[model samples]
Structures are given as C-alpha cells and as structure tokens.
Target: MKVKDGIIGLLIGDALGVPVEFERREYLKEHPVSDMMGYGTYNMPPGTWSDDTSMTIATMASIINKKSIDYNDIISEFCEWYENDAYCQYGLFDIGNTTQLALINYINGNPALECGPDDERSNGNGSLMRILPLAYIKDIDYETVENVSALTHGHKRSKISCVLYIEIAKSMIENDNLDIDGHIKIACDKIINYYKDDKELIHFKRIFENDLDDIDKISSKGYVISTFESVIYCLKNTDSYKDAVLSAVNLGRDTDTVAAICGGLAGIYYGFDSIPIDWIDTIPKIDKVLSLCEKYEAFCDEY
Candidate 1:
C-alpha cells in the first residue's frame, strides 16, 4: 500500500471539515460542505488541517526518528506540537479538550502511558483521529494500539475504538479484493470475536452487526463511539473518496475528525489518485507531509 494514499487522504478530509466543524446537523443539511472551504470556524484559509493531522504527522515523525514505537518520544513529539505549534500548517488553532488536558498531564510529570484521563467522559475522538498511521505498521499489536490511544484517551472504550479502526484500515490495506462492506465485515467480525465479552462491546453492537445505514442512528458528535459510527456510515453509504468525506463533513459536528477517519479508509480503498487535485493543492505544507509519508513508509518496511 502507498503511504501517501492513506495519509494524504486523511489530510484532505481534515481540510474539508476544518471550515465547518462543530456545526449542527440541521444547519449543515441546508448548507452542506461540497468543497474545501476557508476562514469559517477557525478563520484560516482553505485546505488548512487541524490537530488531527498534526498529531498523526508527529506520530510518524517520532517513529522514523526513533526507529521504533517509543511511547515517550511520541508523547514528546505531541508536546512539541501542542506547545510550539510544530507540524501545524500555520499555527495551533484547534485541539480537543481531552487531548489538551492529557498533554498538560504529560507536561506536569506524568508518564506518557499514564497521561490520559480514564474517566468515562474523556472518550473523545482525539486518539481515534491520529491512530490511522498505526494501521500501516507491520506486525503492530493490539496492546501497542491501546497504549497509543491511552496517551490521550485512556478509557477502555476509547482504546477499543482505535483498535477497531485500525483493524478496518488494515483489512483495506491487506485485502484489496473486498468491497467496502466486505472489508468492514471482516474487521467487525474480528473485533467481535476479540472483544466479545468486554462491556464496551455492547456499545459497538450496531457496528458489529453492520447496522449503520439509518441516518437517525448515526451521530456526528465528538464522542469516540459516535465518531466511529459516523465514519462507517459515511464510508458504507458513499461511492468514492470525495463522496465519502463530503458526506462526513456534511454530518456537521466534529466534522474534521469524522472525515479524517473516513478518508483514511477511503484513501486506501480508492487510491491517492482518486482524490481531487484542487483539494490537494489548497493544503499548505502538504509537500512536507508527503515527504514524511515516504520516510514513514520506509521505516515501516524496515521494521
């Protein structure tokens, strides 16, 4: 699999939703996001990505530099982005509350693995948004995926969401012959078989059962479960990468995170060439991101 196909796919989706993030579903129904927009929520120009892409890039950079998945170094890279705006397109303008608090915990002497809050309320999409890169790593284990999610969202529910997402992405990367539903079903079956007895599995019944077609049941909120559901709903319902992400953006709240998550899968399924060139051109620092993807792909190959 080409690293840029999924990574840049995620970047384009983030840019598409940055302008309309937090908008309610009702508002977006009348004025849907059809293209990349600028200067709306964050007042930044079009094609500007948010913390989702920054944290993702930071993770890849740390892995390449350390030649391994060093949790401490990865957290330090996140701190660099949080405090110094490293890896941002222009500046640090957006971040989830859970992520911000976790970084502060790390800053105040907490260990990288212990920095995230374990409270039930801390289950935002912060970890899920950046966990896509892990899907590309060869022989990555579930425990490592959990630890990475625990860096900002330690709740078991949040960790499970990240793992399930990675499972789906890995399916796409490894099994290109399957249709979208086929890929999702394979991942869902695995998650069900692995985490069947966990209490959090109850929360994932809709996904495990492939029950995401109803729009009323899907949500576009910041909650990790809702975000995961939205990603699946958007992907299952749309035909192309552009349609999938645009469907996600129009769902409104937490638009960037949902689109980013969905776009990662769509990018892998459709290939990088399927993404619109105009949208790719609007993003600043994209060349640097592409360079990082090359380096990260090489590291994964050698790992």
Candidate 2:
C-alpha cells in the first residue's frame, strides 16, 4: 500500500491523457492511445503531467512537511506552484477554473477554507482529483477530508465525493479483496448515514445510485460526479493496472484527469509491481517520484 504507487500510477495516467484532452470519444475510437504520449494539447514531452499531479504532489508535500493536514500549508504550496512553477515538470501549463479562482482568493489574503466558491456550479472534479494522498494521511477525519476539499471547492457534493473516494481508497489499501461494488455500497451507505441529518440525500443522488446500471452516464467531464463514476467504472471493468488507466484515457475529454484518478485506485488495488516498469521509467523525474513514495510509506508507518 505504498502511497507513491498510486501517485506515480496516477502520473502515468495524467501524462498519457495530457496529449489528447479534448478529443471526442469518436475521435479517440479511431485514434486510440496505446501508450504514454505527449505534445498534443499542451505540447509537452512524453512524461510531463498537468495540474492534477502537481496539486496531488502539493497536497502530499503539505502532509509530509507539516506532518498534518494544514490547509494554510496546502494553499501556500499551491500558490507557490502556481506562481513559481514548483513541484512539476515543464512548469504549470493547465489549471481548472475553480482551482484558479480559489488560488486567486488565497492570493488576495482570504483564508484557505474561505477561498473556494460555495455554489452548486463550483462542483468541478478539482478537489476530488488530488484527494488520494489524504486517504493515506494518518488519523485523517472525514471532516479533514471535507476541509481539504473545501479549500478549492466548497460545495457539499464536492466534499461528499472526496470523503467517499478516500474511504474507497482506504478500503483498497487495507484489504485487497474487498468487493468493489459491495465496498462502494458500504461506503456510500455510511456517507448517507453520516450526512443524512445535515442535507437532503437528493444532492448526491448519483453516489447513492448503482453505477453499473448507469454506465452510460459516466464520462470524462470535469464534473465530480462524472469523474467519480467514470473512475469506478474503469476500475470495475479492467483487470490490470494498464487496462484500468487506458480505459480511463480512452474516454476522451478530461482524459488525463479521469485516467489519473482511476490509475490511483488501480495502483493501490494491483500494487506497485503491477505498474509497467517501462511506463515508470518513461516518467520524468522517476527518482524524485520514488523518493516521495518512500517518504509516504514511512509517513504511513509513523502515524
């Protein structure tokens, strides 16, 4: 259950999808991505990743350096990366609209938690994408996950999505054989139980519904529900790490993010050994990624 296994696996997915980000599904069907590619959308090299990995790494560094879930540190790190191009290869080329707005609020001296918009439309996959690290954070609470998600997205749907996703990740990391559908059902039930008193369950109707029957509803859109369903769909349908992530990439439009999110789950379920060594080698700054993985492993043990 090495955290970096998921992180690097996610980066591979991000790198693979970066090139073909807005290509339609029909276009991708005709021109399938068989391997990690580059220089199409962002025109970067083969191993370069987008804001997904950068923000995920920022969240990881905040946990490691601060030894806790420090929202201030997380926002500061994100600003550093956004302003100075830190913690990424070839600099920050892309960012989500909600994230950009939240960072702007941070730059204007608003508190990190207050930065994100609270509207329903603010429900992009921005927070959900980088939340895998928090699943490995020691003694993390669902409130902490909510707070983390709120740093960039203040909607309840976004918070619930993070909480559920992290719970699923925790389940996979701790128990290899946990049935995906059953585990997800349990996780969703718990979410419903926990939040039942606070808000109507209708807002998160998608999370409560059976996703297998709603496979047609899944997509690579930037919406949190779409990403959440799409990731789970790819994981359920594919057996190997390669197949899971490639399935995500083929969804097209927001390809990098969908694949990255799916790759994170697959990496945990399949173990680091499941990831292709050639894919691992092709990623830029492989040594650095491995170093982070080691630190994350120790972090998990200590706390």
Candidate 3:
C-alpha cells in the first residue's frame, strides 16, 4: 500500500460523494453512487468535492509548504481559500453553524484557542475531518501530532479524538503487523486518560468498548466523539475499501463526511490498489491530489 495511493483514494472518495452528501437513503437507492461515475444531488459534473476535500487539501498544502502543521498557517489558508471560493460547490452549501460562529469569533479578535465553544457541547466533527495530513508527515514524533491537534482544536476531547484517529492510521500504515484490537485498546486508554472527568468521554467509552456488531448502530451523525467512533467501527468491521466506504455512506446522517473520513483511513490500511480504479479516475482533483501526494512522499523521503 503506497501512502501516495492512500492519499489519492481519499481525495477521490471525498470528491465522488460531495454532490450527493445529504440525500436520503431512499434517494440514493434510486440513484445509487454505485460507481464513481459521479451522479448526485449537487448536479455537479463528476469531480467536484465539498468542504471535506477542500479542508484536507488546505491541510496538505500547509504541510507541504511549511513542512509542519502550523495552526496559524492552516487557518490563514482555510480562510483565504474560503473567501476566494476555491471550494466553489461547497461554498454554496451551508457551512456548519458552529464553524461559522467560530471563524467569525476568530476574525473578530478572539484568541484562536478561545474561538470554539468552551462547553462540552461544542464537539463537532470539523476538527477530525481535516486532520488526515498529520497522518502523512514524517519524522515528527507523536508529540508533534498531539500538539498540532491541540493547536487547531482547543477542546481537549476534540484534540484527543483527532490524536486517536491519527495514531490508528499511522499504526496501520507503518506497522504491517499491527493488531487492531491492541491499537483500539491503547487508543481507548489514552482517550480515557485525557478526558477522565468528562461525561461525554465516559459515554463514548461505553459505546466504543462494547461488543456492538452493527456499524450502522454506531452514530456517525455529527459529534466529534461519535463520528470518530463510527469511523473506527467502520474500519474494524469492513473487509475491503469498497465495503468500508459503502458501509459508512449507507449510514443515514452525515453520510458523505463519515464515508470520506473512513475511506481515507481504510484506503491507508487497505492500500490504494484496494480502492476501485473507477473511483480514482472520477475525482475532480485527481491530478492535484496526486501532485500533493507525490510532493508529500518526497518530503517524507527527505526526513
């Protein structure tokens, strides 16, 4: 599994599902995105991606140019990109209310750390969705990844959730002999340690550590913890890249974003070859994503 291909697969999946993101299951059943041939509600031509891909690309671009995860740089790039309508189709759709509010606060002179909600309820999946680039950077220790997460997402629970997902993805990519159960146990332990006092963390632990077999039973809706857990569930249960994403996309709410996140990790685990070629061919930014991957791979080589 070349890491480049894994990244490419992620971009492809994100773009392919963007147009049909929130359509009901019945709607999809009638017009299933069975192939990456790219037909969906947005009525976009086959390759347009939503905020998922744009933010990820922004993250990747920051790492490539800065050679590290600089929070200020990422925010600047994100705002600049959004303002310039770089993500044209996605801008037409509503940005998350929390994100909009947070960005507004940031723009109005609030400290970046203080921009997001102080309450536990501010746990949207925005942070997790844009963190995949950290999974690709090289030589920087796990401490760097954790620090970067905290910088972008001030909430400890949100930071920890991003850390866990990155750790799982890194283990899969670097350790051929990685044990999934062992990885999950380690992640769960670390998450518990970080948010031991929080009730949401307790609830997350109960749902995550249980013997729940249904992927759909796991909530992939919108909360950071739930979305992270759902992605983990999809990764653990599915046998192939196709099954992993299909399972995630079929789960009613927040389907596209969940599938994109799961698809990115699964692509890394299963390798790019495991992803369908048709899907790769259909991504809107195929050339651009591949270029970034190549540049990232070169950067990894240097380190």
Best by lDDT: 1
State the lDDT of candidate 2 residue by residue for 1-303, as single tens digits.
688778888888888899999888888889999887779988898888889999998887887898777899999999999999998887889999999999999999999999989899999999988888988865678998999999999998899899988887887777767777766777788888888876635756765786354556667789888888888888878889999999899988889999999888888878889998888888888788778778877887898
TM-score of 3: 0.85
Clashing pairs in 2: none
- Summarize candidate 1's per-residue lDDT along 212-240 as a digit string, tens digits: 88988888999998998999999988899
lDDT for each candidate structure: 0.92, 0.85, 0.67
Ranking by lDDT: 1, 2, 3
**lDDT for model 3, on a 0 to 1 scale?**
0.67
C-alpha RMSD values across all candidates: 0.8, 1.5, 3.0
Off by over 4 Å in 2: 197-200
The TM-score measured for candidate 1 stands at: 0.99
lDDT of 3 by residue, 157-234 (tens): 776677777766776777766656666666667666765686656646643575557654566677876677677777
Better of 1 and 2 by TM-score: 1
